[model samples]
Target chain A: MTAPAPPSVAGARSLVEPVLRDAVARLDPLTARVAGYHLGWSDPYGRPATPGGKALRPALAILSARAAGADVGSCLPAAAAVELVHAFSLLHDDIMDGDRVRRHRPSAWTVFGRSAAMLAGDALLVLAGELLLEQGTRGGVWAARGLAAATQRLIAGQASDLEFEGRPEVSLEECRRMSADKTGSLLACSCSIGAMVAEGPAHLVAALAAFGAQAGLAFQLADDLLGIWGAPEVTGKPVLADLRARKKSLPVVAAITSGTTAGERLAKLLAQPDPLSEPELAEAARLVEEAGGRAWAEAEAEHRLDAAERQLAALDLPRGVREEFGEIIRFIASRDH
Target chain B: MTAPAPPSVAGARSLVEPVLRDAVARLDPLTARVAGYHLGWSDPYGRPATPGGKALRPALAILSARAAGADVGSCLPAAAAVELVHAFSLLHDDIMDGDRVRRHRPSAWTVFGRSAAMLAGDALLVLAGELLLEQGTRGGVWAARGLAAATQRLIAGQASDLEFEGRPEVSLEECRRMSADKTGSLLACSCSIGAMVAEGPAHLVAALAAFGAQAGLAFQLADDLLGIWGAPEVTGKPVLADLRARKKSLPVVAAITSGTTAGERLAKLLAQPDPLSEPELAEAARLVEEAGGRAWAEAEAEHRLDAAERQLAALDLPRGVREEFGEIIRFIASRDH
Candidate 1:
């Protein structure tokens, strides 16, 4: 249905998995167990489980390195580092958000205690920096710097998101900035880090970073849509989960600021003190669609995707590499989970 | 008292505070405000406050660099990074431990909220790595790697500390190992990272690290003693704070494992469910002393100080530098708070 995914997706996972596991193994036993569980590498009892996560960030890193004309293995540390940062952010975010589910399973804080999950997140973050520094090259240092900057932005984005929850008035522009920082920073870093690690030309690295930034925004729009309307089975989340949480996601923000009767109704519903009932959530969803929020998000995502594609097209990469990047971008735009 | 505080302590603080402030300024405004408050540079309202914290780790870093024959200013980044890491750990630990007060004021989480404090801590951690990597030197990479390893051990130590809270029978050796990981690892890194960043010889770095490890254990022993009997005004903590939390600090663990009648009584008293009353806490402190926990801890601190001194004496350094290191070690061993 989605062109079967680019080969680089699976290839990146295979190459980066061992490195990730090894880095996690370096944590203390209890932390390793918690981290391993959160990463979907094992069950609560430490037995193997189906590996979880899309490994999308690492795939982007690997593809960026490939575009730089480096061997696939050249950017392994960078790839692993990006994924580790992503994992770290998710673990902490779940605890802060009080979300009990992640990747279709009980979140780490729900499985392990909050303190343990928090420590595991800290361990992963430290391990990411260690992994990159262990490369012992200037490129490694450069990549580590990039990753750290991105992580800071990601944290700021999350902070803003939490702040938005308590505020009644969140402009769509503010929501978009939050999405860019929360998701786009790491994605852009992931795209450029591999090329940076491979000593790619400056122009190529910048182009890839720009492309990833646009794609990341597109990816966030799709995710926000899923948060509201995605099936529970496909998205590994409850129906209308965002609306239930009163999350000021892009569509919700767009609707709240739409200046229409349906938008006004939706805002009033979200402003209520009690949690929304199932029927109310359904009505809220309908109102968001009726207010043109859903259509706006869809159009914005498409626009971003086109911009991402143009950036990739202008790059002087091999055809296969370009096609691989294109396929991953499209996959992200259409992913159900 | 205790040879009048070492000039290097004040000197290090002066040298590193600006750099530390600069690094924290890079964070988003809200996180930066939280971090600033936690660092004692500002009040909850963002107004300037009297500076807090002893800046001992940064002093160690600066002194270690001096010991390596590098200019005192050369290790500012390493010193600032170590201090940032320490602040990061304290911020998160306060949240995890539910501590309401820190450095004689409300903890960051209490002043702001848990989520904001956590994000601030996360921001600081990322900024620490970024500072080191920004140096763009091979030594910077090496120091970042060392800091990362120490951070992992520190997290492991914290995990063990939390785990020990529920377990009734924690062996003395296990508790000691936990202390080494929790406190010794970072202290050791702080002592050695300066030299590592200055490209000092391996032997010098190793000696500095060993000295720091020994001093760190001694420092923890002293801190555990203070937790039981130190003046609340001086310690900026409630009387018998650790006991109130049922923390398995070294002294408490020693008393519990002492195999004396007093130790048995202390254990029974601790095993009760509700919060310990003030009188009960006082009684428990007396029992710990009667059970020889206090004496044993004092002697162990002395023993560790001797080892630390021997390591420093063997190093090829100027007399003034040696005196400075000696003064700090002595201060650590004798400090009441």
Candidate 2:
């Protein structure tokens, strides 16, 4: 009757939140106040606690470990670490993007001031390292190295993203590289770290990483679509927001590089110095679809999904648990918000 | 004849630079450009490499390991990590403080954009962790946890620093806590991590940390004095720069809280809405001295230096190496640049 709990929801509710709370509880009171508020765990004045994010990364970590035949309780630190890294990225990204709202509320920078948000993000990053070091017995060093490598790629991706804002001529290949580095690498790290914590065989760990990587790319493509076309009420972002900012998302890059007539018109419309009008924004979306960008992105997402499924098949996990991961990927690729 | 290599300069030159270079070399070109320039490894345009900082933290790490009876080479990774963390803090601090010049060159945030500088600092922080993970066999987990704890305290210190800028009535105890978290913690970590990497006895590691903590406090006191009185050409900072910015440095705090006639006058002059004139700045400095702030700080520095020497003597290190660390502390307390 409840539509069957999401694949990893039970484990997340029981295992992840407690570990996360324990780690965050160790922060100094001031830094903890800012972080807790930003995470939706408390109000601006730090009294009432509320539900935060979906716990997607931590759930993935826990599920991956379970699928690898490990005791889920023993891997809670690794799972919490994955969530901490994700939270760290969000806090900094909100500042970099000048985003005023996140999760339908004022962003941390708006409420806590920019310097506090910055320090809170830095604190989360350091906390991630501390969690891994505390859990260093079960492949902690390996997980720590993977997280560092992924963080390097994440920073590179963000730097490239900022650079792309100044120029609209970003190529499709460059966009793909950015997507892999920004989203795919961290997702892959999440899955691989879970397996590492489980002490799974090498082949299984590699397979899970590959699965997460492909799934991550697909998830990004879906997010790009939502950015441009999803209902503002549901997505919590204004419709055609990406176009208004002239962001060179994947579809935009694909259309510009298509060299078709529609692509040319789209590029010309986007090159103007002024902000876009509503009518012009609508036409731009049409131009992208007509230029085959929409088609190409849709097909690419499907292809990535298939590749992820194949990778999952090779992971040597129980059929039921593998199905759970497969369903999660599907949700990522197809969800409207 | 050659000043006996300053305890660990040979180890720094022979081992630390190569490791540091290799780590920075691995960053993506865009991120690497900003970081390399910030480190004084290259010009802003990525030209020939130049010399960088004094390598003080890394050298201290190596010297600590040597005093712990380990081969210096075994601890090079830890040494390089210390330098990386130091550089990370400097890059971020320059941005937060709105400082335009560093080491007589434009700061990284001014040369590149703020975002690039921020990413470069994040990159360096991540690299510090990666380097530790790579060298994880010899006390890798221990060193990683120590660095993470130190970074958390550092962030807390910076957050407190920013908070203090808004309220000028900070207490002396609050200032001391900030100084310990900001300066003493990382310096202490530099010594402890080196000992950890060397797998030194616990007593030796704890003693080195205590010595470094005391010395770090003394170093900050010396820096505060330089900020107020050292010549611009020698200190690379304008005269009374801290006073001009109304910074709550140790001496300034002491003066304001001294409850004397001169202290009352200094407070009234600083509370003005307008910036202080050059003569007002000079008068403020004289008022602080007249209130006994300068004498108090000098005595405190001497007391800390002596305590550091006693801690070093307790380490059971060979007399030569112990004296070398003592001499380094003396230099830190006396250096103008």
Candidate 3:
């Protein structure tokens, strides 16, 4: 059984949802409808539906602000901005990746058509900046710069990820760098932008950013593990989804670069032009295990988690705030979906 | 042939090009390459090439600042930011509209692939806000807000344009609003954002914005006319390109809703499934003119230009700045390509 979610996650969601909805409401009607559906605030017909995703990035943003001794109200805009950026990235990435499903539903591009969905994503991105700048403070400008820089890195990482699909071989280092860029940059920004917006000390913001960067890598490693071994119901995707697509995810790259006979055999299986059968997929999974890819990913996640903990330990944050961050770290390491 | 071109246009291009290049160079190599090609600064392979387009938006921005009594250097960032946003929209719009060519060359998506071009557009958008916020002034924050709002409206307008393609009927009012949102919003923002960044008086900013809105509508009207009658050697697009695609451009919509027998014939022709033959396309263009669409568009453009002129006439400005504005207005009204 999974542990209960940290209280900060639920609290952050309640605070950020209204702000996010208000910003989206400012979009044109059709674009707003597309965005509403994508955010899981409603079905395609505009009827209310349960919201999707864990709101983890906004939680991190609010927690960062709290750790900096700022009121929750002061961080709401930053938290919402980060979440909006996350939504924008997912909307565009789904189109590029041709992934038809998101949060167990049809992707926005599939439902609203590619052009409308693309415009909706663009609207959200513009709104994210508008929300931040409307705060009318120096800190708001600083946070906006941080978010923009992170977004550029995120786009670059995605470009590399797509390029990897055409390449026959990818180095483990390149794969790691791609993951850091695609996933870690935004997470690190989310962790520190709220503090920057709160006028927190530079050292504290740096420490929080470092902690988040490590945690984000661990989160990505766990995600790669799930892509190969996750339950379809839990992950909202087919079993061995990454392997089925022959995606150059971290574990697959690690196994291919591992110098063992099993690694070489696994690479050959993936290199074949035809689709892999069920038995072949299972065999490939075994070969990856034999080559120590799974073990390496798991150990790497643990090491990163340890490093994240060290970052917090070096800071003189309030005891309660530190404990809340520790809870989030544990949640990241243990999440199954 | 083009009235020797406006000196302000050349001056603005020279001043803004360096700042624009500096911002784009900050992107990842792949994205930066795509942006360079889209901006006409380089060929697809990154070799230097002659720059394309008139840099009209940046010129309007610089002129706005000058009219507000500020030095051009103080407005450079805002000028570059507006131009970057313009480039960003073109890159994405080319993809959305399935237009394979721009400025006499292959569109960015066609050259770099759609996914890379999309990411490059996304990168330029983020960079636009970054450039503004980096100014570290209250006016910078104001300018960013203005840009963000304009971009949202622009996206919304594009969304409506795409929606119009799927519908059989669209009112002239709907079409006008779409044009205002899609094209007018950005132009108006470009006209005023520079003055805003310079902390110009509220009255001057308002006057510049009004002039830009009227001129922007005039610009779109001219564009619509060119799409039907423009020479391939000049416009870099085939003759009757909009009619070939059955696009519901302002002229086509105006003709269809004109209530003339010719309008009915044009509508029926566009509704047919098969592509229009050359003869049929020419016949359709003739019908649009017979239905008064061409004359209507030309007269409306003149009307808007007159309105734009009155805006400047009411303002107190230096002779040279006013003359430059008048030159651009005349250029807009008389240009054939």
Instruction: Write out the backbone clash pairs for model 3.
Output: none
lDDT of each: 0.90, 0.83, 0.89
Evaluation by DockQ, superior candidate among 2 and 3: 3
Question: Alpha-carbon error at B323 in model 1, in Å?
Answer: 0.9
Q: Residue-wise lDDT of candidate 1 within A283-326, one digit each (tens)?
A: 99999999999999999999999999999988789658888888
Q: Model 1 - which docking category? A: high
Which scores higher on TM-score, 2 or 3?
3
iRMSD computed for candidate 2? 1.2
- DockQ for every model comes to 0.82, 0.72, 0.84
Per-residue lDDT value at A50 in model 1? 94
When summed lDDT is taken over every stretch of 10 residues in candidate 1 chain B, the lowest stretch is: B1-10
Q: What's the candidate order when arranged by decreasing DockQ?
A: 3, 1, 2
For model 2, what TM-score does chain A reach? 0.95
lDDT of 2 at A44: 88
TM-score of each: 0.97, 0.95, 0.97
Q: How good is model 3 by TM-score? A: 0.97
True contacts kept of each: 0.77, 0.72, 0.81
lDDT for each residue of candidate 2 in B147-256, tens digit (9 for 90 to 100): 88888888888888888888858998999889888888898888678888777787888888888899888988888877787677767678898899888888888888
Instruction: Tell me the alpha-carbon RMSD of every candidate.
Output: 1.7, 2.5, 1.6
Interface RMSD of 1: 0.8
